[model samples]
Target: MADLVTPAERRRLYTLLSPAYLWLMVAVFLPLSAMLFFSFLTDMPQDAPDWGVTLGNYAEFLSNPTYGTLMAKSLKLAVTVTLFCILIGYPCALVLAKSIKGRAREALFLMVILPFWSNSLVRIFSWAIVLRGNGVLERAINWVLPFDVRLNLMFTTDAVVIGLVHSYLPYVILTSYLALQAVDDDLIDAARSMGASKLTILRRILLPLSLPGLLAGAVLVFVPVVGSFMEPRILGGRMGTYYGTVIEDQFVAVYNWPLGAALSFILLAVVIVILAAASPVLKRAQT
Candidate 1:
């Protein structure tokens, strides 16, 4: 009976999976192929057909010192935000993971995630409002603190960093908490019984064990933050422009679709290199 149904069952399973396979090819593969193809093409004006397949776009991006500087600035901001997220979020996650019970923990987690549900544009605007010179925090600070110290929070790189950290903090918290939750309570008790200092236990046991999750969270937050256009657009104001803006201007303002695509793939390449570098570090940490 089993033998008779096995082949039929396998055929049925394959039939069910066929749609998903087709979807993956259509949705993922096709777009990636198009992007790869366009990335090699030269920019064309609206009146012109095309500038033909060439390395000019890539060459321009790489050769220009200004573009390189923008890339470096974006990377620096991302690193700063990622570090801030780790430092602030890890402790919050630990507290949530260790002591908070079921419903309350769920509520707190929901609260943490709630901001992310809002549109990214909306979130940025909200922050912009708050960080404005006469905004709530600024007004409160002025009212409470000493004379004439008006904080110029908006339109600076610091504002962009703060926005990135705020937006992605939940990812770090969730990952770190999940990692912390996986550690055995019995082992922790054993370490305490052996008179291990709290700091020593955390440094030797907890940090090493949680490295995977920390790395995972870092990658999650850092990658998206580095390429993010909206936060920089709103919070960056005049002074703190990132690489995304340059790519955006090429495509939208300059009508250089080919060059925009090329810039995007360049960004993709850089991100891939970063991930490739991290892969070995992640593997080593996990082991």
Candidate 2:
């Protein structure tokens, strides 16, 4: 094969790409590099004159079971939120893409994304109001049902899950909607003409084609949820302590920047490993 670009074109390409590469270095890589350096230190250089480089922070992770337990809890929460998002978001996306059209589709999509317009704290607080004992949810249930009941869900794992799902559900819906919309309607029509069942078409055709987008949404949801502390703190109360909360405490309350950096890097490494393991499956879906 002939070379796709001459030297001049190659130079122009690099020239155009240089600004983005530079920005990525400054914005992302530079901070990460600094953190990696910090993670190996005994203490912040400014905090202590006796500070020295050591592997104790990383070693602590291996020696203590608490960190592992919290990490496992975070991963479990991430998985639960991702599954709920897929279950709820995909069907909404499908309906928006295939069932509705024009103004109605626009209105529904606007609703789906409305949460993004509001501050996340506001959203969490709103859920808090509804979930607290004798709150709106409890009142509504009591009003409709014949019996009195306490529906306080505040400060629970379930509340944290609900808040997270509400916050991240749109990622799945938007990605899946785009993927579903790209499918040729003619193919579905042809399947219908051939008397293929809707289940068969969905299972063998639509789902397979949309797997890449679904997985993308799942990844978007999973990565952040694993490190989430705010939603859990507000919603889970004392129950909301996860790996992320500990990391937050280390940085903010404890002022243990070195240990916090180590924990954050450990999280980043685990996330990378998970994505790497899933890459083959994502590639297969694309094919």
Highest TM-score against the true fold, candidate: 2
- Model 1 clash pairs? none
Best by lDDT: 2
Write one digit per residue (lDDT tens) for candidate 2, span 15-106. 99999999999999999999999999998999899999999999999999999999999999999999999999999988998889899998
Q: Name the runs in model 2 displaced over 4 angstroms.
A: 1-4
Error of 2 at 213 (Å): 0.5
Candidate 1, residues 1-287, lDDT tens digits: the string is 35646888878888989999999999999998887787777644445675578888889887888888988888888899999999999888877877697999999999889877989888888999989889877988888988766788999888898888999999999899999899887877888999999888789888888889888999999898877888888898897678888888876898777778887888888989999988998999898
C-alpha local distance difference test of each model: 0.85, 0.94
